[model samples]
Target: MFRAIGNEELGRGTLGHSLHMLLAEDPDFPSSTRSAVDELMRQSELDCAVRAIIIAVTSAQNPHDELEHVLRSHPALLESEWMCDIRATLREFGCFSLY
Candidate 1:
């Protein structure tokens, strides 16, 4: 069996949080997509955090809520080695806190 996903459906169905829970048991919706979904979700979170980190690290203005959602959802990201370095660097220069 072959299924073709058109452009509109491709955009609408993948790369974001548009997936529905009911599809979990559907054979057409492969279980292997779980990692893809997690990667996309992490990408979304990373986009927010990276932009916020850039802003906070480069300017006097704090990231404020821009870092909230991602940090809340994936707190471990803060403890990652790179993030620890960023935080440590910022702290040394009296820059902003990412928390």
Candidate 2:
């Protein structure tokens, strides 16, 4: 399923966060499965462009456009460190989605 989702380009309509929410919601999903997704999200190659977006924001012609470009060009962006930091900061304030 991981290979299928990662390799396929079926839903331009699908949101990345929605998939994360789905995984978080699935009570039947194994811990190994969730770990796989999280591990995949942490990979450098998959997340490089998103990091580029956050880094490029000040120089970006349009910050929003650059962020969107990052998302479109690298859909893994949300699951990457950008989102992880967001999650961690939120967790510091006592809000966490993963647990």
Candidate 3:
């Protein structure tokens, strides 16, 4: 299902959209399945901390809390160069308060 969602030929739109559809329709979906998908998403985002930071900052009402959650969840990213770049970008965008 993750592969299907990631496939460009499916015209399924974004993975998030496909996952939402599956979640809405699949009563038998297990928590483990959701966890696996989440892991895959997290791994995919690992290469782009800026994207993750932007998402964390922009998607939450409380960006500080959201960023803290992200840092806790991905501790390896704590001192990564990408994380530094993300902070600078956020600062330039006037979103450094999120940190």
lDDT, each prediction: 0.39, 0.42, 0.48
Candidate numbers, best TM-score first, in rank order: 3, 2, 1
TM-score per candidate? 0.31, 0.34, 0.39
- Runs of candidate 2 exceeding 4 Å displacement: 1-47, 81-99
Please give the lDDT score at residue 97 for candidate 3. Answer: 27
Clashes of each: 0, 0, 0
List candidate 3 segments past 4 Å from native: 1-45, 85-99
TM-score of 1: 0.31
Cα lDDT tens digits for candidate 1, 27-70:
64432333333453466654334333333343333333333333
Best by TM-score: 3
- Residue 20 miss distance in model 3 (angstroms): 16
Residue-wise C-alpha lDDT for candidate 2, range 1-99, written one tens digit per residue: 333333222233334334534554656433434344345456654543332233333233344544454456446667676655643454455332222
Could you tell me how far off, in angstroms, the CA of residue 36 lies in candidate 2 after the best superposition? Answer: 25
Q: What local lDDT score does residue 21 receive in model 1, on the 0 to 100 scale?
A: 32
